[model samples]
Target: MNTSPTNSDSDTLRVLAQAIAKLILRFRFSRSRFLTLLDEELVLQAKNNDPQANNVTLSIRTGINRRYIPQLLSGEAMHSKPERLKMILEDLKWTSQKHYQSGKVPLKGSFNTFETICELRASGTLTYKAILEELMKQGKVKVAGNKVEIISNNSEQDNEHREFARNSVEKVFYTVEEIIQTEKN
Candidate 1:
């Protein structure tokens, strides 16, 4: 039995690593933090496979310090900003239902308005500009002369934008599945 990984295995690993790197960068995860989380996941898998497995075994297998394993396992990581952005968009959509007039809303006001809706959706965690930027980037909203028009709810109306959104969501799902499968082993 050949113990070494084949070329196909190496290529697959490289692609997986690239995907993980993108996720880490997009989510602003620090390398050390990701490594710690990975170590914790490895420990969990080890324990699942063999109930007698301990931190020392995990450290030996994952090359992470045994001292840090428990801390890593106990700490809860924050949810991804993109997921939060989706929630914010949903909140914006709900708020827009009441305020939308002729498919557009004035971007001026402190209450019950488009600007206020964005702020309320952000809940102070994201700046108004940041929220608008994300919405505009996704082609979900368009700004023109002090009016923000609802171009498409979640970019459903525009085929190009819809495809982009679909690809993005698919990437998130793929990454999640990959992580789960990795942990299972």
Candidate 2:
């Protein structure tokens, strides 16, 4: 019994130590990769039409310094205690592949759970009293609870709403422009 306990203790300690080492190595590599990605994003953004481009843009945009960049990219900074560099390289490769793989954005329709619940009620899925009872049972639509958290549409108006407003403004502006052009003629 004593010998078994000793072996178990040793095994537990070994597992814990391995987990800690792995976590440390992962953090070191993740931070380094994060810096590299930051630099690349900065360079790309600097080339784009954004007006804010300065010397510190390399550091500010990439969130990394030139001095650290070489150390990180070379894999020297991560230091091969074991599979640290390999893991980071694998992660970066996957990310690169994902970036290169182009696909059309999937179309999405309007989804409102609140509206669905109302429609279900109208269709006699349950009576209003039955719905209230279900809500009380679930604790989500709490009645007696000290704090009743209501699910509300807190999200801002969707793109469709913005598009409608934009089109309305454009139509008005174009009409005014046409009138001006006609008067000038």
> Candidate 2: TM-score?
0.19
- Which TM-score value belongs to model 1? 0.44
Question: Native-vs-model 2 lDDT?
Answer: 0.43
Cα-based lDDT for every prediction: 0.68, 0.43
lDDT of candidate model 1 versus the reference: 0.68
lDDT of 1 by residue, 100-158 (tens): 64656667687655677767656668776777787788677878888777676443445
For all predictions, the C-alpha RMSD in Å is: 9.2, 26.5
Clashes of each: 0, 2
* Poorest lDDT segment (10 consecutive residues) of candidate 2: 102-111
Q: 59-90, model 2: which lDDT tens digit per residue?
A: 45456665554444434543323333233223
Candidate 1 Cα errors over 4 Å, as ranges:
1-19, 23-44, 52-83, 101-103, 121-125, 153-185
